[model samples]
Target chain A: MRHLIDISDLTRDETNELIETASDIIVNPDNYTNKCSRKKIATLFYEPSTRTRLSFESAMLDLGGSVIGFSSAQYSSVSKGESVADTVRTVSCFADIIAIRHPKEGAALVAAMNSPVPVINAGDGGHNHPTQTLTDLLTIVREKGRLTDLTIGCCGDLKFGRTVHSLITAMARYSGVRFVLISPDELVIPEYLRNGVLKRENIPYVETRSLDESIAELDILYMTRVQKERFFNEADYVRLKDSYILTPDKLAHAKSDMRILHPLPRVNEISTAIDYDPRAAYFRQVRYGKFIRMALILKLLEEAEE
Target chain B: MIIGSIVNGIVIDHIPAGRGMELYKLMKLNELKCEIALIENAKSEKLGKKDILKIGEMLPFDYSILGYVDSRITINFIENGKRVRKEHPSMPEILSDIIKCKNPRCITTTEQELPHKFRLSDRESLSYRCVYCESKAQSN
Candidate 1:
């Protein structure tokens, strides 16, 4: 693919190839250190995102390439009313590849359309973050040893959790994958998702307001923050957030090998006490996130050569 | 029938009753200088009541948006005051710059020159999502 706008942009074989590349990078670090030694990557972040921005920067720097561009929109030409298309076009003159995180949906699509180099969408509103999905997949593959025939439970804000949405989209292409959607009724998975991806793909799924009831059956529990702002009533947020929290006590009923995953910067969704558990794969997932991005940067640069 | 048939134009028939004015406004029929007739509450054996529109000019009609608005609409070609062929408009695979993407975060909303595009995601549900963001289009 020319650009990484959504998880669907990459075929299953391409996704697996990236995972393999990342695994190879993990083992033979020195051999791939200076792969992009002469190239430059522009982190054109039109939004303030510490983790994603750092991840992209690290991906380029670790590959022996230079990183450029602003960390936020306030510091960029966008403050002077520059359009996303124009900003990407301008960056194309300097950078060999561009990674953008924007507050607006489809900002990367605009960048991709205008960019002379390959464009990678770091994150665009709540629309998509394909790299995050890549990280999650790698994490799951490492922990579970396979992607298919697994019961994946997504907890908390399934309504607005782009990570969960992307995970579902990617995993649905596999065989014997089932979804256990855990969220409050108001924050339930969108109908378009249930009707569009799950039903259309014939992927089995079951929904519940309570995660505790289904925790034992899940092989992977993907937790996301249930923000207070998403709830119409403060009382509802207070009441519902507690139901989704993953404490050690909650994991008592869970599978012995159940891997807990989160797109971190988590806010009380997964307890700090649970971090001590061997099954908690979120931190390890961060390293995979960096590697997958490294693989993506190299892949895009290689594709640009043709 | 209060108006005569078109000499050479389009005949939009079988629009559900009470939708003629909406279709008229959406099509901007009033903006056209050529003759156009809108019949409300027209009788039909297939439909208890329906609306019909006749335009004496051939213009590009976004069939996808029309399919979304009213799939039952039948468009008939009239040549020299005779019906030549009739077509039942079905949803197109891709729709461009007809139904606007209302999501403020959408690229088309800010980059005014770019065409607002949507691809049919769920043909069974008659669902169309924005090509860029994949957000479901608000066809209603």
Candidate 2:
């Protein structure tokens, strides 16, 4: 009964295998279309996310598996005070696997505790999101042709960006990978992650306020939105919101082959004009997300049989 | 004044007043076959208020149980109306099977088959953390 509650749960080989499987799925989508013909997937999204929910639904539908579950807490029995343990237990009786996304920090772990089937953590509150990490890994592999020997630049809201944290942790395992952390002083990466993962692993990284200066040296540019609600003071939020915006002019300094990535639902962090640029890989990354999810469903179901 | 202390018995002193009965309940002293006397609130210059428990036998007990509630207990081995040995509370080495980790994401908290394990990270601060999730506790 293996569960992916964190990114570290997968070893280096297992991670690569998943990426390879996703690539294979991308090449010949019609060949493995009926892998899970009679299987069922239950998506229990406690938080309202149109993008992630639709991605999971599309992935399951592509695999020929039926999808059934609620998209929000208000529509679920959770609004009537049902515990996560009880809800997962009940859902497991009908579905072969479950994907859960919740606002509480540890709600997915709680569901995994009581679920009879394997539980996949879609996303837990500002905590770890293993699948998004998988998507980012697939993107890096496809774009760069390798995962090592690259300078990855992560800009904006590093302090609260779970995607950035997960990507950094996963990339630290590879060789010759350096990091350029670009953000304002208030939203810089927290000391725990800096000291615990980066410093302890002896990974070379530099903190900078200028994104344009470091953009030319990067092989990957990962941009995240600077959210307003995360700030305690509105004035502080307004002051630093525009500091990390990526416009087409900013792309002039970047390398010709440098790939730009974002976990989308972009709010002016990367201008719409840059969407036409060949360097923007975020939309392609979304398609890769579905391919990898389809691969995941097949692998999990195969493992269940053995 | 529960007569003279018996030879080769354990004496617990300096417990906070009004908590003697609670300590007695915690230790289950009443179930023991040995004679026990629980002294009520007594005025002391150091503690200001204290209680004493005199047991008329060398009972098999671990003094570390007091590490959770309070650290003010003193144990003495009285022999022929004289203190032969004394022991004071020291910080425990490993805290387990006593308190559960509050982090619901912790492997120990989620896995039913796993045992709850924590290590004392800070001795002076009495801080403990779950070995799995790294959630901290002030005292346990």
Best by DockQ: 1
Off by over 4 Å in 2: A228-236, B1-140
Q: Tell me how far the alpha carbon of residue A8 in candidate 1 is from the true structure, in angstroms, after superposition.
A: 1.0
Pairs in steric clash, model 2: none
Q: Compute the lDDT of residue B1 as modeled in candidate 1.
A: 40
- Under CAPRI classification, how is model 2 graded? incorrect
What does the lDDT read for residue A44 in candidate 1?
90
Stretches of candidate 1 above 4 Å error?
A: A228-239, B60-65
Number of the predicted model whose lDDT against the real structure is largest: 1
TM-scores of all models?
Answer: 0.92, 0.77
What does candidate 2's lDDT look like per residue over A104-217, in tens digits? Answer: 656677788788788888887677788888999999999989999999999999987889999999999999999999998888998768987999999999999999788999
Clashing pairs in 1: none
